[model samples]
Target: MEVDVKLFGDLREGRFEQEKTQLEENSRVIDVIKKCNLPLEHVAVCFVNNCQAEFGQVLEDGDRIAFSPPVGGM
Candidate 1:
């Protein structure tokens, strides 16, 4: 399946800001994270198709996923 992905904050520093990646069938959010080599600890939230998602959330073809690193300070 092909999933559209985007990264926010420092998560995209050494990686792509947005991309369309191929993943195995039934791949979950965490799978994509691993495929991108993102630091699991830094992933603060996930959005699938613009809605909040959990790591175990299943992904589908053409789904849009955004991964954001934790934001701090006030």
Candidate 2:
């Protein structure tokens, strides 16, 4: 199975801003995060195919996944 992944903010450091990745059947959103070596605590939002999704959300082949890291500004 393959999915499109988008990383936002600091999450893109040393990683592709957007890319496709292969995964096993029944992979969840968290799996993708781990595969990207992103800290779970830093992830503030997740979207699948432009819809809000939870970490436990099951991923499907060709699904579009976007991740946003926590943001802060003064």
Model 2, residue 6: what's the lDDT?
A: 99
lDDT of 2 by residue, 1-56 (tens): 99999999999989889999999999999999999999999899999999999999
TM-score leader: 1
Off by over 4 Å in 2: none
**Colliding residue pairs in candidate 1:** none
Predictions in order: lDDT: 0.96, 0.95
- Count of clashing residue pairs in every prediction: 0, 0
Cα TM-score of candidate 1: 0.95
| Candidate 2 residue-wise lDDT at 57 | 99
Q: Give the TM-score of candidate 2.
A: 0.94
